[model samples]
Target: MTQSGFDTDRPVRLGVQLAPQHHDSYQVIRDAVSRLEDMGVDILFNWDHFFPLSGDPDGTHFEGWSMLAAWAEQTERVEFAALVNCNSYRNADLQADMARTIDHISKKGGETGRFIFGTGSGWFERDYTEYGYEFGTAGQRLDALAEALPRIESRWAQLNPEPTRDIPILIGGAGEQKTLRLVARHADIWHSFVSPDELPHKLEVLSRWADKEQRDTSTLVLSNELGRRDEAEARKLHDAGVRLFTHGVSGPDIDFDSVQRWLDWRDGING
Candidate 1:
């Protein structure tokens, strides 16, 4: 494990968010999934949204949880989840049940499962408008998320056969006051969007939050986007305590050439 400035001695792990949008066919996504797991990537992710976020507003898109269930049966190793599930879209207890079912399906024969519950307070208003959910204030949404997480955990515990393993809660976002505090209290993994330079400060804030929440920051895995970052920036982030680096890819026909560089970089660090 690489020694970051923080108390994290975790191994470097590579992840990719395969955007489930703009795909003309689902077969393209299936092939990409096979390739990513074969490439020895550590995690797989897809976003939770009703429409495309890039290219075309009306482009073809697939639902997140549905694909996640398929991934549960399809892949054998890599952990998978929505890049960040919108808590506003579904009932908290229902989300817990859905995740548990997927957890059960992901197991081959062992007692463990590879489902990461990556979620966030939603930001896309069109999804709310079309889906008939109220487009509430950001604070309200975050509050809802805060309220829902406990219910989800309670539901997990009450389920017939509890989740194969503690489904890792990966909370994504970097807002100092609310999001980071939630991450400190609940998240097993904290995925950040801030740049390398800003990471130290954000982490400092998170540390403070952890202290306040009576949680140890060392128990949380730090994640960051690997797409726009150069190797130097990535190393900088790594030094700051980030262990899980994620790059995102979109598809009709997805390519792996760009991703190969990240894989090699990850191997170089973890090898």
Candidate 2:
């Protein structure tokens, strides 16, 4: 797999979100991983949520890190991660150690860049309160994330056998005051839940912040969720210079057919 950067040969990439919450989970995700890799999807993402974001409030949900570990071992091609790992769930050091473990799993047979550490300041109130963690204010969580990112980066270096490649950091959020600014400084990939009309302004702001930080705006992998399965919509984002497009499906019994269609579209566009 190619390491994501300004010069990656692929002009656009498509990823699928296997929502760990609200799923048959174990089997649903396991099968999904192999199928996606076989179908040639670029990345597999699972949201970090303790409770099902949709469906029953008390539905079965698997933990993110462990699922990712399994995915690392199970799949040979696709890169995987929590679409946005909740920063409030684990300490910085522990998260780094877990990431290192996953990196090893993905590279067991040989070195392959099949993991991306996508993280964010957690927003769900239920996750923290139910898990006995402090449900601090948004600002507090973002501050913790800003501090933790460097530590996670440092810990990767400290590991005896380093990652297969420089583990790319994917940060998610659109908070202009804090999140986007941090993205400008630290993110290898920045994901946002924004509408088509709103993206141009956010891109401009991100570009300005990159200028101030002396970072190349193009260096950041711009990712966003595809709200609908419209080819034109995906192309619109690509035209705006967004290269990574993501679509999500819940489990219990996922419809991989739709995801396959998106993958086809991705290939057709890039081809």
Candidate 3:
């Protein structure tokens, strides 16, 4: 049961964040995408960043959206997106249009495009500073995200062929005041980095925000990172209501063994 003392009918899903960093060849990432989809993970994520987020500060890193476009064409079954696309990096309407185009690219034989629009308020200052965007306050970024989301949705409505489906919006962050409120109003998935002990309070706050927004909280899927988590801890997290879990894998090389472990865990949990 969750913090709300209930269980959801939603099936468990596994996502892996394939960081577009520390790689010499884009082909390495391309190959990783093909193998991961074949391995049966449900979702694939690449973060929106200009440079390597870990290891060497100046290591080779690829831009995220273009890689996502490649992923859209490369993988058939798995949904893909930026783990959390930064709201500060692009124009809202333009973001919408780009997403719509990718949505079309991922379509197969009338199946809706396999894209998830996971987004967040911009946080990494280097991405903004190096790219010539203003590195504003966190609150301002959050406010910008809140404003831009509606514009994105509106633009999607006017697009030519339209998104293959109502592309699910996944919002990352657990800030109760602004982030949770935004999640209540807009997110289909709420991804958090907090520990299981902290999730209940956040969910309680989300419940309040959902009430304020007059939205049903039950439809909201909770997602958490599975980095360094063992099965017992993961089960605790699952009981606390997180159904979607994503483990991050970085390059020079993708961790196929760890990916297999997660798939095994996903199957075990679902069964």
- RMSD, one per candidate, in order: 1.6, 3.2, 1.3
Task: Kindly list the per-residue Cα lDDT of model 1 for residues 163-265, writing each as its tens digit.
Answer: 9998999999999989999998999999988887788779788888988999977678989998788999899888778889999999766769877889999
lDDT of 2 by residue, 69-98 (tens): 888888887888789899989999899988
Show pairs that collide, candidate 1: none
Candidate 3 local Cα displacement, residue 103, angstroms: 0.7
Q: What's the distance in Å from true for residue 238, model 3?
A: 0.5
Better of 1 and 2 by TM-score: 1
Q: lDDT, candidate 3, residue 261?
A: 93
What do the candidate models score in CA lDDT, each in turn?
Answer: 0.90, 0.82, 0.90
Cand. 1 TM to true fold = 0.97
- Candidates 2 and 3 compared by TM-score, better number: 3
Candidate with best TM-score: 3
lDDT of 3 by residue, 136-224 (tens): 89999999999999999999999997888998999999998999999999989999988988888888888889889999877788899
Q: Per-prediction TM-score, please?
A: 0.97, 0.93, 0.97
Q: Tell me the number of clashing residue pairs for each predicted model.
A: 0, 1, 0
Candidate 3 weakest ten by summed lDDT? 1-10
Report the error of model 1 at residue 259, Å: 1.4
